[model samples]
Structures are given as structure tokens and as C-alpha cells.
Target chain A: MTDTPSQLPAHDEASIRVDLQLVADQIKADSRVLDVGCGDGMLLAHLRDTKHVDGRGLELSMARVSSAVREGLAVIQGDLEADLKHYPADAFDYVILSQTLQATHNPKEVLEGLLRLGTHAVVSFPNFGHWKVRLALLLTGRMPSTPTLPESWYDTENIHLCTIKDFLSLVDELGVTIEAGFALDGNGQKRSYKATGWLANLFSEQALFVLRH
Target chain B: MSVLDTSSDNALAPRLTLEGPLVLQSGVSLSPVTIAYQTYGTLNAEKSNAILVCHALTGDQYVAGAHPVSGRDGWWHHVVGPGKVIDTDRYFVIGTNVLGGCMGSTGPKEINPETERPYGLLFPVITIRDMVQAQARLLDQLGIEKLFCVTGGSMGALQTLEWAHRFPERVTAAVPIAGSYRHSAQNIAFDEVGRQAIMADPEWRQGNYLEEGTVPTRGLAVARMAAHITYLSEPALQRKFGRRLQDRENLTYGFDADFQVESYLRHQGSTFVDRFDANSYLYISRAMDYFDLAEENGGNLADAFKDTPVRFCLISISSDWLFPTSESRAIVHALNANAAKVSFVEVESDKGHDAFLLDEPEFHDTLKGFLDGAARTVGLDDGAQGESA
Candidate 1:
């Protein structure tokens, strides 16, 4: 009975971004999920339609929140840093944070909040130690910029950008168990390098992880 | 933009009178409560398709058709027709003249069975909770076990929130647009000024104007004129009618309404007095002022909604200073604290508080989407489009 096309585009299984696809592959079907920075709810919608997951989202932008809600996804307009403490412990089976951890003011605190709120956590972030980034910083003596991390350092939202090695070190510091990990290349294809090896840190453009408390 | 008209000519509608005495939040008991309501569309056999639409301070029960009194179209006619966003073709819409309203409801204008005269100031002071309680009673009489949704704007939003807080089991989804958990100090101050204007009029006769054979026309008009200014943003006012002269070449060099804004306010005030009771304004505004959801739930707004099953969608206008987007955000934080399923939208608009009643496509579209999604979750099949009546 609706007359207008929804402001939010419907997400299909094939169209979901590779990082999100990797994150979705780790989550059990029909599990309760909370997407911490669900931009327009692309992953949540795919999970709801494909796996029948009970998904909810928390987004900061009002425009994205409205788009997500209009697409029939329940999304609260809120920031990850301030709003994560509100959910009770073990409220969801999986809490997903996709490519938004570095943008947060306190990545450590937000990550801890994620583990506390869900039984398992799925996280993805752009790697800051790739060869091209090193080349830009070492050869030019300036801040690095790659296709994945395109924004200039002065105007970038990624204040706490981390390499794969740095992220694994934080995971070790938190004493959380890593269920699985993936190193993705520039084309969003999984690379052959081991996620924990230094080669992955120097070659891969992005990293995805499945962790549990 | 048309002037604000709160009057109703008391067109024919169904009225229900409860048998027992309904207690008030102020520790006063009122007997033989009567609620005037109008229904559009048709109720499904399971009766889960009913949506209770609460009206704002000056609104009546006529929701999607011509008004009985002003002969104007319903306030939300754009959103509640057969093929509209609310879609009378698919849902049963019920609108009620609030408990302390003037449009054929039990209010100051209604006669007290105890004294056989108009209640006037003697009518028991009511609160937002009381209005919701009365509406609940009317639903009980109608055999509606649960409502598909409860929604409103401004004062009506107050009642909608109260419904979700007090009767969560009865409401499946709740939408409170351009509303707050409680009235702010600035809003309370504005209400005070409007009240003082009505009481200052000698013809008011101390809230017994009906018995005195007089009406507080000037005082009420002045109050309406003053309150109307808060409903619009400065930019909207400027765009619609700036300092431009009212049908003249230049200033008249006198106190006459040389400005179009002044003339518009005067017309808004004058017409408002024709159909509204000054005392009802006082009672309704007072109810809004007393509404604090946190205070009602042991001083924690989240506690009021803890473990509640009702889903929520909160909408706020970008330029509504009276009830700004910050208020809706605060409520969202509380709902999130309780892990309640909640959705929020701050519609970009310069139209201010009245945007909820206007033809804001974004607002209407978001509301429809939320309802459509909620309907699916509740197992409301599209086949259940009740026969329109």
C-alpha cells in the first residue's frame, strides 16, 4: 500500500560489502544481534532477510537512523561511546562494529562495552600498516593515505587508526579469545597471509575478527 | 498558514458514560465520566487494528473529515484518509476529545450531577495520566482488548507516553511526535501568561462566565494570539509575513495593526475565542505542566519503561523550540537504557511544533514505515484490511 520508494535502499545478500559479509558469515543464524554503527542497516537487513536474525541498530546520524527505521529496521539514534553502557549484559548473541571503531573517541572502552553486552563480538577496521601507507609515510615524510583510508589526516575521522598487529595486541591485552580472523586486500578479497602474521599487517588493507569473552 | 482554531461545533458523535467514579491524580474523585469519540474505517474481528489518535491541546475528535464546528478539514486529514499514510482502508482510527476537553467531553463546560450546574472551576483538576485513564475506560466499554498503536503530538504526545508507561500491555506500539517526557520551565511560564490573560478578563467572572451570561472574549483572544507565536519559528514567520505592512503602503503612524503579523495574530486570537472555552485551556495546559515521566516512575525515566513490551518510535521537528529534538534524544537514551526496541527521527523542518499537523512528507513517510514494520512484527496480515465503514 505504500506509494513512495523507501528512503533506505533494500540490501541484498550479494550487495553487502565484503567486510560486512565476512562479519555476517561468523554470526549464527537467527541469533540476537546489535549493530553498533549500522550505517543505513545494510548488514542488519541482510541478516534479517537471509538468516531471520532479530537485529537492532545504534547509529549516530539522524539521517541514517531515519533511513534505517524507514527500511523497517529498529535503529536508535545514538553514539557508540555514550549509548553502549545502556544495554544489559548478554543482551545479544553478537554485537557488530564495522569500520567505525577508529572513528570513536575511545575504541578500547567501546570494544569492552561490546564484549560485555553480547556473547560474541564481530569487528572490522581498515589496516594502517599496509605497504602503501608505509611508502607514503616513509618516502614522502607525510601522513599516509590509501584507497581504503582516503581522507587526509587533517580532515580524517580516524583518530585512532590501528594496524592489524596493534589490534591483535589490544585483543591480547583485553584477554578475550579470538574465534576467527580474516585479512582482506584492497579489492575486498581475503588474502592468503595469516591474520596474526606480520605479513598480513604489511600487505592487507583491512582486518575482520570474531572475538568472545 | 491558517490561524489556530480550537473550536468545535459539537457535531454528532458517539458518547460513552462510565458507571463508576474515576479517581484523579490530584486525589479527587469524579463520577459518571463521559468520553466523546469518533471512529473512522472499521474494526477487525480480532480488534487488533485499532489505533488511538490523541489530539493536541485544542484539537477535537474529528480526525480525517470536515470539522463539525469550524467547517474546516480535520487537523490530520492529509495523513489519515482512505489511501493516506495512516490509511483508513487498512486500520481502524479512533479519536477522542480528551477528558478535560470542551468538545462534548466531560470538562468545565459539562454539568456536574452533584450540583446540576456547569462544573466551571469546580471541575476536578486532571493530569495527563487521568486523560489516558479515561481513554482506556472508553476502550474497555468498546471491547477493544489491545490497540495496534497509540499516537499524538504535543499535549497528545504527553497522553501517548502516559499510555505506554501506564498500560504497556495494552499498546503494541507508541509514537509520540514533537513531544517531551515532561514540560519545561519555559513552557510552564508561557502557560502561566495565557492563564493570567484569561483570568484578567472581568467578563470571565472567575471561571463562571457561562453562568454570568458573559465570555472572556478579549482575554482569551489575547492569550491565543500570544501562544500562537511560539508555535512557529522566526524564519517561518519571516518567510510568511515579515515586517511588511498589512494591506497598506506604509506605517499608519498609529497603534493600528500596520504590520501584517499583528493583523494575523489579531485574527487568530479573535477566531480562537469563538469556539474555545477559556477554562479548558487552563486545565489542559496545567495537565501538560504536571507531566514528568521520570518523577512518576520513582525518579528514573528508564524505570518507567523497564521490561515493557511496547515498541516506540519518537519523532521531533528540527526547529521546534517548544519541544526540541534534544528532548526526544533524551527519551531515546532512556529507552536504550532499558534495551527497549525504539526508533527515533528528527525530521528536518523549519515549520516548528505544528509540523506534525502539517503536510511534512518526511514525517508522514517515516511514520508509515515504522507502522508498516511494526505491523509485520505483530503478525498483522495485509489481508486484515477491515471493511471501511
Candidate 2:
């Protein structure tokens, strides 16, 4: 997600990624949500339209933040690493970090901040351990790059990229309960396989987890 | 022309004097208070689309049309015109000269009825809340029970916040851009310097310059020069002027406007004195310094808006060190603590505090979105949407 140029989709929220839409589906109506690294606020807008959710966003890029705010979403220009600490504990019903976990400076601390700020935390990230990425790395003898993670290694912002297994281990260490999870393939289609275990990490192009303290 | 004219038949700026004396926050009663204002667009049958636009320190009632004194276009014409962000075609817009303003309002420059002379230093010290109180009187006279929105920037933003705090039920929504709940220490210091500059001039004559048959032009110019610097960012200055020479290539050792920056500052100062009153500057700046909403609410910012139903959209400029984004965030935190409906946007701009007045597309978009959203909740007709640039 970090490797892809940050292009805002059309105003139609249906054009948002399938994983983000799935995340939106889990949220109940009228709940307060905080979208970290919310980009142009597609999911927040969608949730506001569908769920009547009171949504707020924290986006690192001012350009994206400006666009989000233009679309009537409550967004502030902020860094996920530094700005998350300012939000009061349990200020939100749900905090969604969609496809932005890999680009954070400290994914664990960011996760801790998310859990602290919201009653439930939804996190999505590209799976670095996918079969295609592994095959490319083994055959090319270099860092793997796939369509989902398209940037050259030197220019990529995915400094802390991880797989489903890596994220599950961190969740276990933090002692949080995973309420729900979803796996998606390379075509941005949700896979019905159990979101955990070895096969999910190797084959799923991306993963989504709903965790609570 | 009498400054306290109670007649409402004036063609240019409409004037109205309140029915009774308005007791000031400083405990001084000001009788026959007058407010000069300009109105644009129709108020509609339901009268629910009224937006009260408060002007900043140096701003006046000219929100959209050309300014009478300066003959230049209104300061916020970019955002307040027919098809602009404020969109006069859709909403009823009213801009007023603040209580302590020099533009056809009862300020230090206005003549005192008791002494038949300019009030000057005799004008009672005012606060942001007091300014809003005067506006409320104006609204009462206009028969407007509730305002759809109240919006402003800089000192105007302070007034916007004051409107929401003092009369929560009267305001449907508010947009405070590049403002703070209280004046920061640095802000007070900068305003103090300007006041001192005005007082230091011999011609000022203890705020009696009007009686002395001479204006404190030099002092007012110097003060304007100092205050104008705070309105811009260092990056904007560097990009616009840098180390470039003015007019001549070689540097003149004799302090004759050697740099383009110096020339620019001088022009800003000189042009300012022609249209503003020095004593009015002192009164307005002092009012701003005394503004502290949190302190007024017993030092708990959240208490200022407890259980208030007003919606808010706060905006700050990224490069505005004078007001800063942190000030806006503090407001957001307080609103959150109170569980008030609020949204905040820190616009990325190199233009600094004055970005609120500049052509920042993002700022306009955010304002349009907030206003449009608020309009929906208030049951106002959307009408024809304005063309976005």
C-alpha cells in the first residue's frame, strides 16, 4: 500500500479497496470512528453514508488530508507515529488503520496507541510473506516487489512490513483478543480461508484483523 | 457627518444604535452603541440561513464589496462573493465592523457624545465576549433568532468562538480558522510591541492625536510594519523577497531601503496608516490580549462548552507559527472532552497565518464542505452549487 502512489479514487465509495469495504462492514451504525492514515477518507465517507458514523481522520500527507477535508470528512494533518499519542484514551469506538501499518516507524507502538485510543482497533497491511513475493525474491535474488507492494526497495516507505503471522504474534504478545479477521488475494478479492495459520500468510496478498484489549 | 448617527437610511454602510446602554465587561456602561454592517443575499422566508462573519483586527464591514475607504476590493472577496465559498447566492451573509473597530463603528476613533470629541483613550476596555454581545444586539434588532453559522479568522476567529460559547443555542455551527481560545504569550508580546510603538511617538499626545491636529502616522506605520510580519511565514518571505536588492543592484550603505524585504515592509506600513486609526489599534489589540475563554470558565476549557449543541469546524495553517496548529488541537481536545460535535483541519500552507485570507484551495474546500453540511442539518435549500476553482 505504501509503494502505490497515493491517488484518491473517485467520489464513489464503492471504488475503495475490497478490504477497506470489508472493514467498513464490521463497524456498527452511529459509532464514533478514528481513521489513522485515512488517505482521502474514502472509508470514512463510506461509513458516514452507510452507517451514519461520526468519523475523524489523521493523515500524514497534507495533500491527502486537504482532499479528505474537502470531501466533508473530519481530517487533521498528522503523522501516525507522533500524532496518535495526543488523542485521549478510549476517545473513539473504533480506530481503523487501513493498509498503513507497514509504513509506520514502530508498528507495535502504533498498534498500542490505536488500542489505547479506541475500544476496538481495525488494522490492515500487505502480507510480505505471500507466495508471489517469496517466489520473486528467491528467483531474482533481491527484495521482492509485487503489484500490491510495487515500489523499488530503495524508494519504498514500507519500512516495517510484516505478514499475517508476524502481526498475530505481536497481538499475542500484547495479549489482545482478535475479534475478527479477513484475508484477501492478489486480485483484491476476499478469500474464505481461515484468516490465521501458515497458509493464510503464504497465499493471502493482504490481511485485516479486528482486535480489542 | 455625525459618527453616532442613529439613522438607518444611509445608502453605503447601514448603521443602528442599540435601544439601551450596553454594560461592558470592564463594568463601564456605554450608551447609544452603534454598529455599522453590510448584508448580502436574501435572508429567505425561514431566516435559518444567516451567517455572521466577524472581521479581524484591521478588517471592517466590507466582506465582499469594495472597501469605501481603501477603494480596494474587500479583504475576503475571494471567499465571500456570489459563487464563492461563503456563497452569497445560497446563504444570507452579514459582516459587521467589530465593536472596537475604526470602520464606521463606535470605537476609540468615534466621537464621544459626552465630550463631543473622539473617545480615543477614554473608550472603555472591551473583550471578545463584549464584541459578540454587541453583535447579538445587532442580530436582535434584525429579528434573527438563530444563526446558521458564525465564521471568522485571526481575531475574528476569537469572536467566532465567543459566539459559540456565550450563546450555544443561537448558533447552529461555527468555523474558527487560524485562531485560539486565548491569546498566547508570544501573541501578547507582539501586540504589546505595536501598542508601545504607537505610544512612543511624540505626536501621539497620550491618545489625543486627533485633537492635536496631527495623526500619529510614523508610530502607526511602525506598529503596522511589526504586526504585518507576524501574518506571514519565513518561507513565504524567502520565496518572495529573499536577499534580493530593491530597485538598485549594489547595496546602499546609508539605510535607503537596500533590500526588497525592507521596501515591502515600508510599503505595507505606509499604506496601512492611511486607512486605520492608531488608537483603535490599541483598543482592539488590548481586547484580544484579554481574551481567555478557558480562564473565563474557571480554567477548564471543556467547561466552556459543556453540553453545548453547536457544531464546529476548526482550521489552522501548517506554517502559522503565530497561531500554530497546536492551538487548534487544544480546542479540539476540549471539544472532545465535552463530547461536543467538532471537526478540525490543519491546512498545509507556506503562507502562514494570512493563509486564511489567501487563495488556498484546500481551505476554501474545507469551508465549503463544512458550511454545506451544516446547511443540510439546518433545513436550508442547497440551491445551485457554486463553481469550484
Candidate 3:
């Protein structure tokens, strides 16, 4: 549950991952990076610890900010909607908002803010149109609960949820230039997001998008 | 400049404040000031261990000596003892009354050179940065290359942070416990209320009340009593006194110290008036308000330390609601942003922000760890653990 004796462990299935190898490969070594919803500032810290990358982070939870800070990471206590403007234009080479877009008050506006502050924006979210959630909604009809969306409808902060296809349409509609796309299956391994186009939206558990403003 | 004896300077009866060209916050200058101070320990070979120990509100330079002016006990007896955290036996600890401070540093009590009278409200406002700049000059005149460490709490911490940011290279290390990069608006507002109270006093006489033996005791006392509330936590206050009545029975039904809390605050206020300069309080608090480290760095507190090589150990008490732990975390965040060598430990204490001065084992341990680590990093000549446990 925890990596170290003095560490706050991941409380749920969602937590920091060593799979930041993929995220680190996409950015320049010295480029400035900002990570939104940067839990324990894992990817940014990895980028900093190895790549000499200067990183900034925005996290809402006080405990997470303290944890990230204790690890010597520059994390700010901020909500995405309220604090995005504090960063100047093109302040970073990449603004990575992984696992946070779906929970924002205005995902499009946040994307725009991130784009304005960074040249490249990387967004990752659990694809709500995945087959299990669809089948759950179709069969049980209780707002769909799965391991991905563990919280009940009342406790969950995940609003404005979307599927891979819906997000792709969002990018196109918002004139966002998609640089790349990756999909993850139930086991949390990366694969092509284009396979069985119909099932990709209904079954691909997570989608990672790399886009330009 | 030959390495003339600093003792010669000290031997000249040590004119603490030569009071030159001290421009106030509102663009006026004060001169011919007096500074109350006390020196401890001795200057070593490189004159490098000149550690300045600043004090918070109500603290005088008698860091290790009886106050010559106020006749009060040394404020930090626990930390300034022979084998204490600040060990006067090895480290030359110099504590000076802040500019615009009571007890000696020129304030409402000092006479204005131009008018040949005390400059009460006419005393220009001062700032924490200004105080630091003045100290830097003093250190330069003393032929000290760099300070081993600048340590303080509360207002003292404010001054220490100013020293680090202002003379980053000169300060080898800094211990700004329970201080913020900028005063919170709430604190600023509190100080403003205190100033207004002093001004609103009937005997204030537009800052010339001293001529008539008119001191704004009531207003100043009220201000002190109010600010005293902020320096402690509800838990500390509650735990100490806890609605217990002072001296008499339950309901006196009059404006008196019916409760212990009331009596305690009154004592703090009255005693404050005895040794503190009311106008100096105004100036020092104003200085704290103007201390915004980020503003000087073009709104990025992190950029202020970008090129500096100073290591920092910021300690904050968790029970200190005044500065709080978040303020310390803010500074840590800034230091980390610049990738500077730094450590932060929010010592768990119920003694409020004043834990820096108390005999808290945890605080000492944290300081020992940081200091030992920093000394090893900088290759300072360490001889055992000097007696301080």
C-alpha cells in the first residue's frame, strides 16, 4: 500500500505509478513541466529526479500537497478552475493533466488554460463509455459502478465523464491537434485505442491523449 | 581597511545605532538613534561564527544577559544557556534591539535631531528588510565575512527571512521558525487595528504627547492585549487557564480581571508598556507588513533563491495558528522550486509559535539534526556536539 515507512500510502486502486517511463519519454529533458492532479507529484518528480526537469503541480487535497511537499516537490494548493490563471502563458513545455480532466468543473476551459500555459498538453482519463460501465448502466441502471469508478453516484466527484470517442470529438471540435493516443485495458496496460472502434469506446478502460493547442 | 580590533569599536562603549540616513516607509529619515544590545561568546579566527539571535515581540537584546534598560530576565533563557541550542560558549550570539524598537533602538522615545524633541509619530516607519540592511552594515563594519546562522521566531523569524533573501550569499544558513514570506492580510489587519488604537488615544497628542507626560497607555494596552491573543492557540490558552476565575469569586459584575485570562492579558499589556516603545511597536509591525519576499522576485518567491547557495531549515510548530505550518510549507515549496538544499520539520508542539524559545526536546532534536547535517555539508569544524543536547 505504501512505498516507504514514512510515506502516505495510496488509499485506493488509483495512485502513483512507475509507468512514468512513457510520460518522461515524450518531453525534452530540460523543459519546464506542470502536472495537474499530480498525486504525490510522481511523474513530475521522476522527471525532476532523473531528467533535470523543473516541475510545478496543482492538487486540491491538503494531505496530498503535504505529502508531495515533504518529498521536496513544488506543489501548490489549488483547484484547477481557480488557480490555472496564476501560471503565465507558455510557462511550461508540457502541461500534463493525467487522471484529472473528468473531475474538473469545466474540462474544456481547463484544457484551454493548460494549452495557453504550455505548448503540448497531455490528458488521461478513465473512458466512461467502456463496455463494463455501459453494460452496468444497461443492465443494473444504478449510475454504473466499477473498480475504476469506485465511489457511489453520491460521493463521486467525477462529473462530465466521457468516452474515448467523445473526447476525440472534443479535441476535433475544440481545434486541438492530437499528437498521439494510447489506450489501456482492464489490467492497466497500454494498447492501441483504435482497435474494434466500437468496442474501443465501450471497453477500453482508459485513454491517454497527447494534443497541441 | 586594516583589521582593526572590533573590540576597539566595542570598547568605544558600543554606540549601537549611529542612526544614519534611516529612511522611513513614508519617505522621511530619522537620525541620532539609540540601540539596545548585548553580545555573547567570542569572535573566532575567520570571524565567521557571528550568529545574530533576533527576538520576537517583547524581546530585548539581553539574549544571555540581564536587560540593562528594562531589567527583565533574558527572554530566551532556555536556548541561550551555556549548553543550549544557541550555546553562547562557542557561537558569538549578538542580539540587538530592532530599529524602531523600544528599550534602546531609536523609537518614539528618541529625540528628533531637527526639532530637538522626541520624534513620536514623526518617527518614520521601518521595515524588516530595512532592519536586515542595517544589520548587514553592522556586520560589515565588524569585519565579519558571513554569518554562521541567523535565528529567530515570530517577528524575529520575519527578520531572519529578510536576511536570507536580502543577503543570500552572506548568510550561510537561516532558521526562520514560524514566519511567513508575507504577512497574512489577517495579521496586517490586526496590526492596523493596534496602530489605530495608539492613535485614537486621547493623550496621543498627534505623537507629541510625551511633552505632557501623556502616554497612550490604555489604547496601547488594548492593542497589546488584542495582539496577545493571536500569539497563542485556543488550546494553549484553554489548557492553561480554562475559565478559571482570578483572585475573587464568580461574578464581580464590574470591568475587572474577574477571570484568569483577563488578568493574564492585562499583565502582558501592562508589562509590555514598561519596557516596550509603543511607537516602535507600530514601526516594527509595519515592517513585517511590508515584507513580501515574492514581490521583490517579480511575484515568484521561488525565483528569489534561484542563484543562492544558502541552505535553510524552516521549523514551524503545528499548534502555532499565527504563522501555522502552511506558511513554513510555502517557504519549503519555494526553496524546492529552485532545487536548493533545504529541510523542513513542523515540530509537533502545543506551545504555540513560542516553541522556538521553550525547552522542547523535539525542537532541539530537529535543530540538532539540521545543524549537524548542514555543518557536515559545509565542512564546518565540529567538535563533539558542543554541550547542547
Instruction: Give per-residue lDDT, candidate 1, residue B180.
Output: 95
* Residue-wise C-alpha lDDT for candidate 1, range A1-213, written one tens digit per residue: 001112212245457766676778888998999998887887899898889998889887777888898987888788788778878889899999988888888889888999999989998888898899999999999898777877788888888989988999999999999988889777677753453477888888888888899
lDDT, each prediction: 0.86, 0.85, 0.73
Q: How accurate is candidate 3 locally (lDDT)?
A: 0.73
DockQ of each: 0.66, 0.37, 0.05
The CAPRI-style docking tier of model 3 reads incorrect
What is the C-alpha lDDT profile of model 3 across A1-213, one tens digit per residue?
011111212334553442354456677898888887776667767787678887777777655655565555555555678766655677778998877788888888988888988999988787898889989999997899887777788877788789998898888888989887777676656766555556677667777878888
Order of all candidates by lDDT, from best down to worst?
1, 2, 3
lDDT of 3 by residue, B21-92 (tens): 656545666566556566787766666667888878667677865655455568887777566766666677
**Candidate 1 accuracy as lDDT:** 0.86
Model 2 DockQ class = acceptable
Each model's Cα RMSD: 4.1, 3.9, 7.8
Best by TM-score: 1
- Candidate 2 lDDT tens digits, B191-211: 999999999989899999887
State candidate 3's DockQ.
0.05
Where is the poorest 10-residue window by lDDT in model 1 chain B? B1-10
Which of the two candidates, 1 or 3, achieves a greater TM-score against the reference?
1
What would the per-residue lDDT of candidate 1 be over residues B187-297, giving only the tens digit for each residue? Answer: 999888999999999988999987777888888888898789888999999999988999899888999999999999999998888778899998998999999999888
